[model samples]
Target: MVGSGFQRLRKSPWEILSSAIFSSILVVSSQLALAMVPHFFPSFSLVSMLPIAGVVFVATVVIGRWCRRLLGVPASAPAFVLFNVFFLWGVYICIIRQAVPSLLDAILNAECALLLFGLYRIFSSDPGMVSYDSSRSTEASCNGFSDFSQCENSSLFPRVRYCTSCKTNIRGFDHHCPALGNCIGQKNHRLFMVLLTGFVIAESSYTMCSTRYITRFLNTSRVGLEANLSLNMVISTMLFSILQVLWQVVFLMWHLYCICFNIKTEEWINWRKYPEFQLNIPAPAQQGSAFSEIRFFNPYDKGFVGNIKEFLKPKH
Candidate 1:
């Protein structure tokens, strides 16, 4: 049943629309968020904003459009970067001003970073034009002959096929990334993972650092530093927390689906098979167990949830 639903989603127009809308929101919101950074952090010189904002904007536009063109999908790397930077900036402000961030700030920052990282993974590692080569080596034996089967001795390197879009025989070809506007074959996969890891680390560090400040605020009885618990503050924090959790769940499921089925984002997006071969191809291999795959810096890992248990487990 789950497989059937996934197959349906693969072909759905709604997914494309959702991807586009989400990407646009990410682009616009990221720009707005970047703009707000200056207002929030008055101490920072305007020059600092230009470099970060410029890199973020260019990366966002390129990635977003690339995803759309390659997979008929859209994503907002800019928004993810914006939220992360600003959220950290907010924490930095709280720390600088009061020497401690409130519990509210810490909670908000941590949650925001987690949410942003999840979104970034979903968009960034979207497997724009990548797919498995069913005809190459896993032929005959692994073709969809049985349910819940595995491929045996599949060829890692196969003959190249010309990509209509790129007009080149891509080596170690996984798929083309519209976001990066390049093929994410073997050579570039590591780079993509590195980009994601950096973003996650930066966002998480900012959140945790701010959280320390928040704890300090909680411990103090300083005259004006106590949280006022105003209606607006309470409501915003609550809503943000709820949204963060919800997004986290969505991300978790998506990651699990990808890992279990071994489907690349690109393959999932542009899944197609020659008419003669469609019925014979078996489903792709599922990777490692969910628990094992989620660890930090796993070569094949795509999102933070793969290591959720490790992340959530209390440190000794």
Candidate 2:
């Protein structure tokens, strides 16, 4: 299923599992962490796991509802929590256990930090909202687009749209992202690309490091209660990383194509509604043809290089 917002991204089973794990870990004490238990002692992982799961489920539901009521940024908190969980686990569990080498770990952690920073920028930055002018309200009303900030002298902001979720008019509006709790628009679209690329890189590195560690552990160690518990957690992390990397990479490619074509995700979906895409350019004429056909054209297309340059240097 797509995420519960305008992102239109997949909600993989691994994502659900990660959210559950994060929620459970958050509600449960640090003592619930398998790492806290001494290796020499009898493992209490089995004993502690069930209660943690149950308590976390209840806590997650309550917290989710509370956040929705107060923040109005659906799924943002969970996504933030999941990112922190991965970083914490990578440092505390994977790095400490030598799953990743020092040099490689340093690079991976830097990428993780970059991803976090990009997400922060997306969440905090203005998305090129078109300021409403009461002076132009009469003109807007006359234009039959009073609800939007696009009328009369606002020919420059052709793709402007009123986001119901944000209660504002966004310039070059693409979509609302529940994960980042922000709208993807002219100002932050490039940042979104950077974030997506960083995510794919970081996730791929994490998956590789996790796979190396898991393989090494399984080959070298004997099966024991404590060992089994640790292995299970690592395995789960690897699985989540794999699933997320696969999904996000595909999403990244799709966005790249849109960028190349100078087409917003929203515009692509509702092309017929936009006058910019209504260029009825005629097809080639034939010698005995009774009629010529018109093909749809994107007026905003400035060729691939020009489109990329425009995206990188947006008019903000």
Candidate 3:
């Protein structure tokens, strides 16, 4: 499935050609900017980076636009502007300049590209929404019903709650991610965490591989720093990597916690908001098992390994 999806995404010859052209341009422009410090600039200044930034921006836009059109990922996959700046810095300092060993750089770039493709897959896949008429039935349609199987979206085994923002009874709706322009739900939450995990791995290795030079250049004397454009490049890239790693670690860990406990982000947030939500079980005598006033209780929570399996299971 993954291979076929990637093939479909890259089926366009024009897209492949355009991406190759922009990637080549990115490599050349970044290398030229990095080379400026060694030969052209004895004391490079911030003002000198304007030309480099302009060139990188053009290349980024071209590639970013192509990715958006092909993969349905946002033009800026990450909404954070800092990520983009750091990406450019990373390219200029390490990737284009070949800061790491040739073989190591190739390996890292390949891994990073695969992680990026994974993100595109998660973003583009439909996340268990029942929008079509054929997929929904009157009997299966849940109107905030207690028995989740009654919902058309059986992918959401338990959750079928009204989403005030979306104005629909969403099944297992975790939350809407504006960055991806999609809802992270029962079907895609696992994929979302996997994507986050991939970024964590990619960023960690990238940082580890380049940390030595980045730190050395950052610690250089002011005059030496000015003479070495890589110093600025490395510093910015390091900062960006650090920020991303920290954020991804915390974010992924939190989601892991949620998965372990068999809870959704949306439920965790509003669990306390409604202490005594009514459950319609169609029988007042069977209230204890079917519907109870068990505050903050997550019915989906199995055991530790059990919940983990639930999370790892293939999304419907």
Candidate 4:
């Protein structure tokens, strides 16, 4: 007998349960950490989490709205953003106190959210095929034709091209993401990069501050009422300063290389792009490349040694 008025769930019950369980665990762990940790550790604060929470909530809402739009549903970005902000602020106050580590954790959490969102987008998208349709060309007489003729026709899934894992077409293709998920093609590319940049800045700043604090802590000496700054602090500070300088120089060089070459992270994974996309752009990849064109670099790529070589490679 056919069951009337019964609809099959689009998402599995176990999947929903797992998601809820994971979210609960994240909240509980964060709350416990905040409660147990000393207030001195900056990560225990509401202020530290605010920015990250805001970014995560906003990005999630934006992606949801985008999905709805694609499904022919009406949605407003402003309303979603506003709602997310309010909810995020509430979570910030309820979960953690203002502290540096807390702030860093918030940023990390936001990055995780973005990564998950990107992954979801990649899986949900349709796989598009690459093909050529010369019949549609209105040009009567083509004085010139090149090897690029095969790229004349757009892929069936115009937003996505090569999927690295499956080595096939990706639906709703945005771009490839290594940090969050596999790729950020069509759907979640914008949100992924936006959150990623924010995460990088937040993480870097936190690391810098923590290193300084650790140096100061190590340098402190137990002295009588007349306490003087120890030489150890001075040495630690000098070492940290040099390390920081070197880190920044390396980072800036890599950024410059990406900008000049017009390469996206996805290109590294699959070496695919639209026929119209060009590799000779002057602006940095992060700053100039469209959301769909940017790619994420793998951090575990030969421990900075290989990275330097890759960054210095000429754009061809």
Clashes of each: 12, 0, 0, 26
**How many backbone clashes are present in model 3?**
0
3 against 4, candidate with superior lDDT: 3
Global CA lDDT of candidate 2, please? 0.63
- Badly placed stretches (over 4 Å) of model 2 are 1-97, 136-156, 280-295
Write model 4 residue lDDT over 1-316, tens digit each, in one string: 2212112124466654544444444333333333222222334343454344344434544554455556544332222222332333333333321323665657645654663454455444332322322442412222222212223443332334545443434433435433233444433434444444543453344345444444454366444522222222222222322333444556445444443453444444444344434343345666765544333433224444564454444322
My TM-score estimates for the predictions, one after another, are: 0.34, 0.69, 0.58, 0.31
Q: lDDT per prediction?
A: 0.42, 0.63, 0.56, 0.39
How large is the C-alpha RMSD of every model relative to the true structure?
16.2, 9.9, 9.9, 17.7
lDDT of 3 by residue, 41-80 (tens): 4355534644454455456556656655675432333333
lDDT of 1: 0.42
As for TM-score, the candidate ahead, 1 or 3, is: 3
Q: What C-alpha lDDT, on a 0 to 100 scale, does residue 267 get in candidate 2?
A: 78
| Best candidate (score: lDDT) | 2
The collision pairs in model 3 are: none
Better of 1 and 4 by lDDT: 1
Ranking by TM-score: 2, 3, 1, 4
Model 2 RMSD in angstroms: 9.9
Looking at candidate 1, the ten consecutive residues that score lowest on lDDT are 1-10
> Candidate 4, which segments miss by more than 4 Å at Cα?
1-10, 26-160, 164-182, 186-190, 203-259, 270-316
